[model samples]
Target: MWLGSEFCARHILRHCDTLAGLPAFWTREQHGEEASTWLLFTHKYDYLKHLADRYRSRAEPMTRTFSITETAITTSPPRERVLLLLAVALMESFGIQVNLCLDPAYRQLEGFVLDRQRCAIIANWVDIDAVWHVDVNTNKPDLQRYADALDHAQARSAIAAKTPTGRLTALAGLLDLDWQWLTHRCGELAAYGSAGIADPHSRLLSTAGVDRACGYVATVATHNG
Candidate 1:
């Protein structure tokens, strides 16, 4: 049950009275439903938007091109990691139980907001990607395929790590300069998962699919300004 920012915002405005009160309400509400996920997402977006505004105010002016690379993302003083950690902290402040999953490829780290009361996975950061539901009711064939591919890739990389030659090959593949290939493959998978669900909300969600949709908006504003 993936939801876009607008849908989340609208739902929150209709159902929730205050952002601070959301966690309690969501905890008491039913899990694994689209409405519940939307409420959670609404809070997530609100927190991210506030964080982006704070970052924009404190950010130093610079003209250098912002590059997104595995090394740039996972190494010490990583920008994405820092921002995501901040997001996790903020969610915790609101009483939301969130978890982070670091991809084996180290390309990206995903955050999942859990329904602690039900011990269920509710919503995840599906930024610029398809939102996945790990519940029994929803069909996630495309997500499963993508997960299988990722597992296979990780398994191969693990085997390749035993030898110097194999290590070099694995490193080359991981650090492959062609990020377009990776992004394209992810877009294809998202498209497949979202097939036949092309409503306006879905389109907005896809466009804003990165970990924090607000962060992407903030980045563009910073660059353009």
Candidate 2:
């Protein structure tokens, strides 16, 4: 994984609507060149000239609104530039920031940002299939709790349509509530089944309850006598 830069970050945000629903990763060199060529080949001079004009017109308004000094515009350091570009790229394309650092084993140098805060200390070395096990150390609070949190969150999401029905004798009053009220209180529960809240089994189902969509197959080997 590559570190993000603000320039690229802004560019990404600018074009994000064009690039959503893509796979998680992209070929950097290819993408960069392609983007550059796309900008150049499609009425090249007119595009850049228009960009320059727009930039100039917006510069004063941006400075006035943000109170940025001229020095801030003229002398940005290299790391800052890279971070700026990457951030712009991320913001445009993914609407997020870079906060996570990939575990060293992948040998790819991309940084990660869990849910988009700027804490970049934690790293996960596990394979992608086992990604759910990645933990957030104390240094990385934004991501420290996500591993299990994601699982539980997903579990709760899955079970939203199902009901818990071991026994209701202890609270018959609660259990015997009107169907219309329950349905009105919880509408998301309707997606999974027909009976919904009226059914005896209206508690949320587990991840196991949700059917896998695609490419999730696995196999095990057996030795027989």
Candidate 3:
């Protein structure tokens, strides 16, 4: 629904040793504010269940919604995959809704997203470091293709087509691309997602150059912009 502060599942598992140690963004002093933490999961499946029960109660929204990006289910080890399935079940039991992010990738997590409230469908392309990167940038036409393919698959699961096995109701993932690209891309893709598409820690505003977090962009763009 609304974009507040978002933290990826793996990052939380990596940085916070205890639930109480969660960033103040999600665990602030004020209790009356309307806020929520978007947990964009990519992996580290084992710890997700350990968190599902603890987070909902502490966050602003008691029954919070969590999000997960396209994960490598088909390629991951069997043990991790099983853990992920179990984690999804646990979240469901806790009354927290989970949404699938990214432009329909045919990950076959239909059981996880079917009829669930849609969350953020972010398409950000970020470079955390020289060796590590995240790319989800996409266009409206691309998303339509994904939706059409998914429809075909459902129609032919009888000779239809398929990609990720579900229809994509997109929102936004702004500040993902460089200024030159985003200025144009954001307008074209806004109808698909949100208008601003910003998350303070992860996808904050920038012009497009280089820094420690985002690798490098066109010369006209800079880190502070």
Rank the candidate models, highest TM-score first.
1, 3, 2
Ranking by lDDT: 1, 3, 2
> Higher-lDDT candidate among 1 and 3?
1
Q: All candidates' lDDT scores?
A: 0.30, 0.24, 0.27
Q: How much is the lDDT of residue 93 in candidate 1?
A: 31
Candidate 1 lDDT over residue span 1-225, tens digit each: 334434333443342222221121111111113222322344445644443443344333111001123333345232333333223323333323332112344233222221112221233323336543222112255334334433444343321333322332233233332323433433454444423343235322332223222232222222211
Summarize candidate 3's per-residue lDDT along 170-209 as a digit string, tens digits: 1111112133442243234333332235433434332111
Error of 1 at 131 (Å): 12
TM per candidate comes to 0.26, 0.16, 0.23
Q: Which stretches of candidate 1 lie over 4 Å from their true place?
A: 1-3, 8-72, 75-79, 104-225
* Candidate that scores best on lDDT: 1
- By TM-score, the better pick of 1 and 3 is 1
At residue 149, candidate 2 shows an lDDT of 37
Tell me how far the alpha carbon of residue 94 in candidate 2 is from the true structure, in angstroms, after superposition.
5.0
Off by more than 4 A, model 2: 1-23, 26-99, 109-225
